[model samples]
Target: MVSVPTHLVSADTEWSPLRSVIVGHAADSCFPTAPPHMIKATMPEEHFASFRPKNRFPASLLDRADAEVRQFVQILRDHGVLVYRPKAIDWFAEGGYTAAMPRDGLITVGNTVIEACFAWECRHREIELGFSEILADLEKDPVVRVVRAPKVERPDALYEGIRGFGQKDAVNGEVNGTHTVHSHEWAINNARPAFDAADFLRFGKTIVGQLSNVTNQKGVDYLRSAVPEGYSVELLDVTDEHAMHIDATILPLRQRLLIYNPERVSKRALQKLDLFKDWELHAYPYQPAPRENPPRYMTSGWLLMNVFSLDEKKVVVEAGDVEFAEYIRKLGMEPIPCPFQHVNSIGGSFHCTTVDLVRQGT
Candidate 1:
């Protein structure tokens, strides 16, 4: 009964000629009362007060982000790309939901589409918003693999300290032998099978990912095994102290070019990674420092690195981030500027809000 596409359903790399994509909806996207570990990880210390359960995202900000996302969709449609939007849901009334940031929940590998296991209870239902759209894609592309992420273990409190260092974490119940705990407490713990779609970046034959508060070692392992034969997954040594998604920290412009935020890449890992030495690693230009009390959003300013690619030579950037665009030009790519500050205030930009569903060729 499902309609399936005869050819592959997805593009292989970030800069490939994009043909189809899923654009997230800002409308009805609800902010979570109980944020996941990764959400807490990336937040600035001062903004902690805003994430409290009772807080609601300013309606004005949501409207701006929604307008910006619509503009982005128009730009893609103008370029002849097939764009799909997620069905809207009442995230606030139906419990915690994140309407935007689709890149955090869904991803496509080759022709296969995978619905990732979100790391927090707050976002567990996010995939529901896009279920109809993904099902349609599956009907059209039967060969595409659809892997549902494994169920995760949710504890009352995820402890982050050594077993003996602090009184056994009474919150999560059982005290496991680990150095960290993943929770609202922001502690480190044994890596488990918890991952967010944003933690991955795809290349033709390989994928590069990072372990952060949102993604655990086991989750990375699961991903490594899920891909089709001939494809590989590599874990990057990026600092995950306030671990979250990697799109803002490292971006591959093309096979040979990479853009990174120096603050996020670990100094130790930077020295040991020989692959980086061979590629043209352009340290992204400076961004204005965060205000003394930056408006506490769910994410950090590194969202500036969240750029989207039309192809190896064309990419979408924020209209206000002139420095990022200039750097894109320096890399020999054309930067298409769009207004995204409002949507960004909600947590992500073009790359975060959009997921590529099809690229032109292998």
Candidate 2:
């Protein structure tokens, strides 16, 4: 029997039976504007020009994206899962990105929900403008806790000393009085804690994450401090040079079974973690074909791995990805196909659009 959750926020693993979640809206979602260096580092080269200030995604795309999201919410409701929607905001007016991908801004660990300290200036106010009301409502639960990101006083300091395009070079730096130097030169410096919540994934008491263009060492340190007691965060060594979010790198279908992108992460690297010592890890055998008509502006075709799990037995997948759907079916999962290509074009897929608020067990 599934136990009822007393708090409004509680989730530790990605494959648990989801009871409540937040589904984002894609209306008025503008392309996120950032420094040329940062944009070039993380975004796809073909879509570089779209990262201009106040540039809205094509109206046709946003309309279809919003439709897909609404349909997705209805599907969740039909399954008896509670769904929360963010307050719609004009991204063009605010000079910010879309509220469509809330997974990048907030993560739920145990009974607490923690916000991300975004590296991009345009995303600093993302959660504030879109999801504050929901956060306030969650706070009403006496057993729930919300940890908001500390306000950044000097955002430009993050890019002060960085130079050149994507390359690997060492640079000495100081973050919070500790001297540090990374082997690879990222777009942003470790001036402050900067990370998108999507960089980390939960697995029972052990939460695995990665250091990417958007997430820095200081950011990981901050996350370690914010998580509830008895929970820990570990970093995975990923090979993708243009790494941003780890959601596509690793997908945990359930407690003991996981599928990973071999092009980005290795089976050996996953074995290094004590958490996966007794788990079954499989490399995704098929290569996803790129989509051109709608155009994947932000990510690669591997976004197919960015699926949302409804529970241990049922998972949400893109309607077009029949290959992946069939593969997971062989692994004992029921893939519910939904038309989300429009949403994929905007930024992310189902996993990137929803934040699970409550699961059967923490």
* lDDT of all predictions: 0.70, 0.89
TM-score for each predicted model, relative to the true structure = 0.85, 0.94
Clashes of 1: 16
Give the alpha carbon lDDT tens digit for every residue of 90-190 in model 1: 66666665567888887788877777666666777777655656656564656777777665566323334424334332323222322343333333345
Q: Provide the lDDT at 162 for model 2.
A: 78
Global Cα lDDT for candidate 2: 0.89
Task: Kindly list the per-residue Cα lDDT of model 2 for residues 277-353, writing each as its tens digit.
Answer: 99999999999987797999898899999999999999999999999999999999999999999999988999999
- Scored against the true structure, residue 356 in model 2 reaches a CA lDDT of 97
Task: Give the TM-score comparing model 1 with the true structure, all chains together.
Answer: 0.85
Candidate 1 global lDDT: 0.70
